[model samples]
Target: MIEANKLKMQLKCPMPKLDFDVITLGHGSGGVLTNKLLDSGVFKILSNPLLDERHDGALINLEGKTAFSTDSFLVSPIFFPGGNIGELAVNGTVNDLAMCGAIPKYLSLSFIIEEGLTMTEFWEILLSIKCACEKAGVTVVTGDTKVVEKGKGDKIFINTSGIGSIHPKANISSKRIKIGDKIIISGNIASHGMAIMSVREGLQFESEILSDTTNLNHTISALLDTFGDGIHLLTDPTRGGIATVFKEIAQHNGVGIDIFQSELPIDNQVSNACELLGLDPIYVANEGLFISFVDESIADDFLKTLRNDDNGTQANIIGTVVETHPKQVIMESVIGGKRVVNMLPGEQLPRIC
Candidate 1:
């Protein structure tokens, strides 16, 4: 009876597999396995006519002036509080074109997958990419996949190339930003960066923080429909945050920009997280927000219209371009003092999208 019990225990013990249900180098070798991976996984979800063609490259037609942008997403932790690298890649590329007053249309997705990553995780990311494209009113018309040896690369990296057409009357440019131009922000800043940090640090707060990782193309298109060329400049504050965007445009237009710290929008939870980390929310990142420079005369009209949009409900006119301090960003402290805001000196958060 003792020997029978011992044999049953040995049968129930867990053991490591000689092989795994994970990605392997052969999946990228353009052989039978490559076709199976593409056929059974990626293409199964992202089914569109152009991608179905399976040509070496996608053939597309663009009318009028087309703006093309490409971005590579290498955010650490693959998945974060609000989004993963897949959604970030899609939204990031779409926002880049939107900043130029373009309507995003199609995209090409490419991936670098590390060996030993689970196929289940890869398929989840693929589905994420598909959903993001649909939400943005864009299509993933082409894609490529490559596999790297384990330990040499992260679990995954994504590269997205987007094509969009410039609006006919859209003459957005830094040169169009004059001293009288007003700066309007879409929503509360720093939620995205703080959300990522919150997950990484495992901090407990009174409230939960979620990343604002979403697409803004619809709202931006509405802005174009409302104010056409009255919009002077548009930018999404991502890596270096609102302060960095202000400094770049201020310098590019050779004008001074002043923002009231009291007017800056921030979430209470994100604020607490920032304070605990000794980080300033202004220099953090954002995913679903943007800054608009518009003519001073129509600033109120633009603000009201933007407020009606789902994402821009928290919109605020944070600052205006001024003639006093050329090529610099000045922030008016809540305590009634002014200070210069510059681009982030170095990498504040590494592997942050």
Candidate 2:
């Protein structure tokens, strides 16, 4: 499901006519072509007071504690079922800040475009970026753009850096996690990875599998607002999937993780696709899912509250911190068995943001 963004509304702008149809090497030269591209496209759609300055860097103010994060997007087939590289880049950085218990405020967007990419494609991407920033309630402050030869780059790659003010009540840290803390997942698992795989492998199911790429900052903010320091640690299982994230946390914090296969939430289509592809959904990458380690006392309330939110209708209490088998993750099977969950030994998917 595409979770509704309280900040996003219908964008009524139409694409502007451009002098050129496709990007050329000259567009990256910091000369006339580059200026024209920015004037007609990037600057026009993403215009804000700070981005309008067109300076080498942006200036902004901050109070109290702050959180900063940066990430790059290179998802193959930049346009996926539910989103494109543009929004993916924005959501990635914004969610990164959210994971740190921050209210995201500003972003720096940079694009590396291949010479052969069409202007139409570029404009759609810019529109996505604008919509994503608006939905996340953030602004594009400063950025750089460069073009590469056809073979030197994929269609396009984006990098975003973001900063935000930390939530006053948030005390998110691994060290804060305790033996009885409950692990709650924001939504279903493996949708994003299976969505990409469906496109790459030309597999079709009863319905289209859309990427779960929506921004999670708002959802996270609401949780922090209510739970405060009761929320110990927050993390999004992006490239490495939840298993790897749990294993890392378990080893790093010297605690045992106990999860149940029966309680793990996953989409029917995603699970079927993973099975057909001989892939384990638990090891697949995800873009819009987050795992929260919260105090056991508040776990039931946390899961109930999360389930009411649009972004977390499918939330589940998947696991808990334990004292046995320290530095390891153990999952009870649907049958009466247990298995060790470890870090992914090799790359399961590539070019997936």
Candidate 3:
């Protein structure tokens, strides 16, 4: 098991003493309490020139094409095995931009807090947001905060919007995918979902499962720098995992996807937990991993280059785009039998992102 200390960023910003121990409705009233919360918590930890201006929004310069994406996070257990909702909010949006072949630059953070939440909990989440922004080399330019009456909302919910300039060499699109293209998974699958399940379901394994939640912008930037247009497309299997992602792409692009069960990458502990729970790892969620569809000629080189990176040590060529079965996904079993891999019937795990 990865140490919890290793999985989480050490608190860099110390918690400041506040007048109130727990939040109240007044904290969201845009009055003195709200100002105190922002000044002592959010603004202090995520300080920057643009954010310090305290404007309704930020002005950023973008020369070429840009990518914009936003998402809301609502996990049952705000604090999970490997990460909390704060980092997940930042990473989820950052990754969405990265998959668009963009270098993430700035983010807007918004929070919905429950009235009874302790100030200490809010401070910890802010520190995590600060750490995540610093790690991704992105700044929090603007945001909003609101507090709801107890029982009206979850402990806390986060929404993040991100914008970035597209990489010059990147030519990514689902339409770019074609027959003979190779599909490569960035790393082991199913880690993030199982990590959350372990905590939510009170299931215990020999070794703790850690969420694979980290920024993938740097890894993607390096790949774009080296491979250029040799890379055809990029996608992350977040909520519905690899199977759902492949099925969506195939149906949308009128293409066929063929995968091998033996080639799929998964950590042993996570795989075991999935077995015990009767879950298919391929349908599980992931945070830090991505799928790269590249020209077949460079498949081996692409796989090698990705494996050399820290985030891609467990990378593998899991599948290929084919023409045999249009608009469908087929997986070859470990015993060499084949079957259709369909879209998820319904939500396998809810609030997983």
Candidate 4:
């Protein structure tokens, strides 16, 4: 027993300088480390006020009042349970504009295909892109394609740029958040992350997991139609999950967030798989989920409107913004304790859309 305890203690010891000799899958995870790499390495050199704000979609003062955003998709296993990379690329860009309270109008697509890729697979991806555009009420205005030598590139890589019209009454920003505001989550967390992980790791459960990759503009429009300016900030929990979103909001707004553990909506299968893998569902990616910051007075009405929509059936008021702790996120445990919900230090799962 003494020897076993010593072995466990040694395993638990922290290694401060574990340099990555080669690129690992986690670099693409879109978690804390990914953000750190981008901010420190790239953003530092290209520093500009516009990019500094780091909003989902760049809000530019265009003559025609347009919102623009771009995103690249490289999710491995290209195809997954609910959707594939094509659908993800389209929806991801569309939703980025929607998060800025814009109506997505047009999109430009660029593809990088590897040599020797099957034409059938490429056709299927194109079909998915077409279907996604139809669902989002957008058009593929123009596109470009290229093929790279085999082994030099993945089977496929997609980059999409989108343009949209901003809502007149919509000026959502994390900086507008106040202490008494409410935090609302659109639906269950960690479904997409788990689905991708399951397929990649060959983990099987009784119930099949599905990715929550869908266009959320419809739901966002519905909520905006009802609440208008009551919504302070809107963000979809994508790569870094709910914890990262909360941290960003809190830091940007100069406020703290306090969430109730029991109020978080999590699907049973997702929770079970997360537990088994020693992961926290709160820090897992969720493609089709969003967090809304709004005033406390209209919290019920907002939640009611969201629940009435199909995409927001599991919507709930999970937490509140506070002035205490200034720029941190805290979660009240189900056992009547509190824990700091820090931003993930590194990636949990990679190539998860």
Candidate 5:
């Protein structure tokens, strides 16, 4: 019964309350209060050897070619069906480095908070950052915070900079793409953009469309393990989507791309949503997907590899590189004709990411 009595006493111990319930300008003033905020909140949640060093910048040892990337998250409706801004911020940067064939290592986060933002909400986002880092096997080694006037900002904006070590066998790059390289898309398109658009425009369809926001690090790693440098290129089609990305790739690599409409992976609900909104799925945003260009000889090997992955079950060989229409993307119509898929004349969906 002594153990039971000890458990009861431990439960009775009260937790300490935050000294200030809401953040103020002073928290960003680099004074005593700022240190308190970091110690009590950021440090408490993101406990790690590098972060606890308490230096102005983190000292990390990365050998070989290191990939570095940074991004800022201003996604509207910060909280979405499948994820919040915190997860998006971490995943986006992590995936950027992964696209470069890097093993993600560390991240630096900064928050731009609006005055009067709830303390609870701020802590919630921090906790999510921690969780995303854990899931991706990365760390937030350093950070900064600033408070803006209420009207000058949304509730909060997050910026993350990531560092990773590129594998020696990763020969993927826009310039490395060659003629006859096959293009493989990781999964269904337009879900993320449609998810945001549907909620923002108050359009209800047959079913709920959730954002496909996810980290592609593991999937890419699996491919690299199997195919190594045979994978010629990797890219996540974000703001401008696959069409725009394909056009840029064709232009940069001096190759023409032919995408087949019949091979495109479009969910029925997403296709219907696009039809109702006068949108095209190929030109919509996707957070959890990526495009891979592989040597035609091993294309099936890569496809089988991705198919074995849970997130890439819908992976499909969507197109091929051609020499005829150099620096252009041509889409073969379902009925058996071809059309030039130019870089979008203008933005189709703004701020969807």
Candidate 6:
């Protein structure tokens, strides 16, 4: 009986040096396995001046006014139709800073790579990041990398932090918003969310859906040149889409908002997809788009200015701030009915950003 118990104990023990084939949850436990993955995969390739310090947060020194923002990308299927995790990470951070009326300048990238991921795919993602940085005219000054044991993580995840200089005279914030302000969207809604949904669910359509994940700093700068302080609020409708964004702005400024459904610019394909999936296009995410609130008198000029730009071809005034329903967001439907658009109680799509 004692000999039998000893043999069973030996059988139950796990091999310490066993090789992993995929990522496991243990890799994310911040243990030895997680550290090994980071040290072996990402850190070796991306060692740089800013990242070499290995600090909890990067030390960023800048001149004049500065804006800082950080974002993590966990969109599934990492590689989507029009963009991937790499491009999304860079653009996401850049746009965040720009939304604050900042001139995006530098970025720090950190990678959480899953074990068993192919080097070729990783290299491709890196290339995409390089291209995105070039397009945004920002330098990737620093970054960190870590790997997880097989089955311990998703395929790959990326986190990016960015710093930018706030453009002089570009005072934009929710606090500046007031009643009678006009709300303008840079372009169509729901494209990015639908694009990711199509890929994740293997849904094919007549026209290919592409993510609108591009840097908005240039278009924002153009608008700032013309509107400047008149632009009260500038925010990108990302994870929770337009409905959530309006609600946030309204709550922040202590005002009410009403949007006209008929005025929202949505692509036909996006509308069809949302209808089929029983998803509200208003609640879908948009990466390459933003909403601007400005004085009613400057609305026309703002619309014209946006329309003239390639990025704002579909720009339109979707709503207005009101003094009546403070801290509430309401929408006027196409059938002439008014309804409240509330914040999403829970996530509509997990890992969307």
Top candidate on lDDT is 2
TM-score of each: 0.93, 0.97, 0.97, 0.81, 0.92, 0.85
Q: Whole-model lDDT, candidate 6? A: 0.83
Model 3, 231-274: lDDT tens digits are: 99999899999899999999999999999999998999999999
lDDT of 4 by residue, 1-353 (tens): 12222433444322223233222334335576446434433244324455456655444544556789998888888988877888889889999999999889777777776765554465456657766776788776655555567687888899999988877767787777888899999899999999999898799999889888888888898788889999998999899889988887777767999999899999999899999899899889988788899989899999999998878999999999987898889999999899998887798887775
Q: Which candidate is the best by TM-score?
A: 2
User: What overall lDDT goes with each candidate model?
Assistant: 0.86, 0.91, 0.90, 0.79, 0.85, 0.83
Tens-digit lDDT track for model 6 on 208-286?
9888888899999988988899999899999999999888878776899999999999999989999989999988999
What ranking emerges by TM-score with the best candidate at the front?
A: 2, 3, 1, 5, 6, 4
Worst 10 residues of 1 by lDDT: 1-10
Model 5 residue 234 CA deviation (Å) reads 0.4
lDDT of 5 by residue, 213-326 (tens): 878898898889889989999999998789999999888778999999999998889889999999888889999899999999999989998998977999999999888889
How does candidate 5 score on lDDT?
Answer: 0.85
Instruction: Please give the TM-score that candidate 6 achieves against the real structure.
Output: 0.85
TM-score for model 4?
0.81
User: Model 5 residue 194 lDDT?
Assistant: 90
2 against 6, candidate with superior lDDT: 2
